[model samples]
Target: MGERGRFLLPKRKKRRHRTAVKMVLAGILLCALLLGAEHRMRPMIETVAAYQARLLATRNINDAVLDIVQEENVQYNNIVNVRQGIEGQVTSLTTDMVTMNRLKAQVTNRVSEYLEKQTMQEVKIPVGTLIGGSVFSGRGPLVEFRLFPAGYVETDLYNDFQPAGINQTLHRIMMTVKVRVVGVIPFYSVTADVNTSICLAQTVIVGKAPSSYTDIEGGVSPFISQYDYGLQAREKLPQEE
Candidate 1:
């Protein structure tokens, strides 16, 4: 080989090495940019997705409760037995386990079916929102993502007594539903617990009201009959003799 050829060989090798280093650095820079973009965008997407999941869960639960109650034509007197004294004074309240159990099962199954069929949803977020620019917010190329929600349903049947008038008591039979929704995105996921209560039936008892009885919104006292149905577990109300 000539001197010129030998000298050019090392120069070419050095240029190739420099090019390879530049290519690697460019690749690393691209990856960093992508990661940073994901970091900034993930929270916004997750927030939207979580809100959607919670909304979905709540709506389904409410629909299920309403459908079951209306379909079965349940009434306050059907599920509760109120005992009164000779003078028509309230003695105690009892829950009919059979009716309550059936209602709970129906509600749970309906809600589960609804959730299973409706868990997957699509959400489109504008790129500008992730950029956090007010001027361009909600105005950019839409980034679409799918949220797959998976979870379980728990139902509770309880009662609330509130004073209606001087001698009137307002008894409300309420059903509470809890749904655990885990929203899964491409590389991220969020969980949300949604709780909702609906009144199945209500009736005013015409008798002496309990002086210690207060509104249920504050909290339930130990004396009240509160049945929490956790997949068939029942809190037995004292059966009247």
Candidate 2:
């Protein structure tokens, strides 16, 4: 009986040892599953945080780009307005210049016409004439008064006169003259004075005489004949007679 008891005790001891080993292995497997789950959850959490940070940075960049575009548009509008104003001012100045040029041309034309009309009415005349004469009467020739287009006198005629004729009794004469422009509507008039002096005389006679008076030389008396009878007789009588 003692030997049977000893073999049963040894078998019991072996069964207790096997049960203890199985309990320890089950505890180790459970700890390994929990650790793996924790490790995987930590990586997922880090990835999500990184994505959120990228989104925030992208939003800020987009906002800054939008602000720059808005500022550029405003500056462009200002430039366009300024250019339009300058163009308008230039147009106004050009219009004024054209008007001034047209007015100047009209004034120049009128002045030219006036000067041409004045130049046409100049005249010249001989130095002797008779007009309602008393002896030593006021009469003379017409002289041209000349002026250039600039209204300055161009001739020296106002300072001198030329003699026109020679005869003692007919020397002094009065003149009345008119100067007319050809193809012009109105005429101009000018007047002057003249004087005469006789240098020689052949005879002097006074009083009247009878028509029948005769001289000893067989010629008619001087008083009884006409003053120009000597010249008339020479003309009428033939040379041989």
Candidate 3:
């Protein structure tokens, strides 16, 4: 009876050790699968999340600009002042500091509010889609993820003047917004930074175009008139006796 009991005890011990080894191997395999899935899904996840965030952010910014424009009755003249010389040439273009600043603040506040209101909205993507093969794409269960502001929404209001046609310069009031968004999945999350610009208002100025222009958006002027080039060339030429 004692010898039989001893043999049974060793058999039980071996079985338990075997079970533990199997469990450890199973755990390692599971971890490897998860890691591989994560790597494979990263690009798809980022693309989807960024697209959703950009769409939402664009809509919010447009809505905010539209609301402010309607509420404040903004116009080209209200935001910009153009000075003309005796020959009806555009000499200087100046922005109304008070109006511009006020509008900028209002836009920033409204965008922030809109983003906050939209943070709860979620985007649904299928697991099969993340797998990203011709056979498995878009064929599996859906996963829910949401976008929220990762940081403060940045808003910039500025002016852009471009030549529209001969002797015509188009003055545009532009707004650029930068939003950092995060997508939260079940156990994974991704972040993206989206930058977008919209034209709030524009007007065609009918006169001689300016030689150079400057704005808060850029230090160097984007528009250089041919008239200025001609003058510079003439000044550099040797004087006739």
Candidate 4:
């Protein structure tokens, strides 16, 4: 209640106001620091978000690309299979063409060999071979002939059958043989001329046959036929070959 008591009270009030002002300033400063930290971290957070987004987009793109690549590979495989099949067919067709009737007289060669080992053999005689017999021997197959154990072959023959008279029926012709008789005795072969009308006989030797012979039609060779007994010859002969 005195003057000193009044002075102490005023000083205490002033000190309290100063403390409150200091507390308010400190709070404002902390708030400003928090705002600055938030501002600095905002760009980093945005960057992280963008990075995550890019990663997700990349994954989606990769998945799409992988799907497309797999589809293309499957298509490629299918195309390759188709191509292989086509190639196989083409190769088969080519093989068939190349293998067509390659041998004319070889078809009966096996049978002839088998029969020759047992008895008389019949085989196709080559051109330019000689035939033995007369025209009155009787009609038979033009391409079939018999081979005896003496290495002599009696076969169908075709040669220059030109007749001087139209009424003079000529039967004999000439042909050549260049094959070895498997069953013949020590290969008894002779290269000579013979006379025959409807049939002929000749000697067989291990050699190539002539490509052509002088026939009534001139220069006739049965081996040259593609559609004949050869791979290309499909027409049936007038006589067995």
* TM of each candidate vs. truth: 0.80, 0.20, 0.76, 0.26
Give lDDT tens digits, candidate 2, residues 75-160.
Answer: 22222111113323211001122322332343334333443544332323222212222442334764333322222111100001
lDDT (Cα atoms) of all candidates against the true structure: 0.79, 0.31, 0.72, 0.33
Q: Which sections of candidate 4 miss by over 4 Å?
A: 1-3, 60-241
lDDT of 3: 0.72
How well is each residue in 43-122 modelled by candidate 1, as lDDT tens digits?
Answer: 88888999999999998998898899889999988988877779876566778878887898899999999989984799
lDDT of 4 by residue, 130-152 (tens): 22235523334343334343222
**Candidate achieving higher lDDT, 1 or 3:** 1
Q: How many backbone clashes does candidate 3 have?
A: 0
User: Which window of 10 residues has the lowest lDDT sum in candidate 3?
Assistant: 232-241
lDDT of 3 by residue, 1-241 (tens): 9999998999999999999999999999999999999899878877887777777777887888899999999888887776777998666666666777787789889988887877565778899999889888888899777655444688777656576777677778787878777655555566767788877778886775455632233232324324442232223322222
Cα lDDT for residue 152, model 4? 29
Candidate 4, position 19, lDDT: 100
- The Cα RMSD in angstroms, rounded to one decimal, for candidate 4 relative to the true structure is 43.7
Stretches > 4 Å off in candidate 1: 83-92, 208-241
Instruction: Count steric clashes of candidate 1.
Output: 0
Please state the error at residue 48 of candidate 3 in Å. Answer: 2.0
Could you say which candidate leads in lDDT? 1
> What's each prediction's clash count?
0, 2, 0, 24
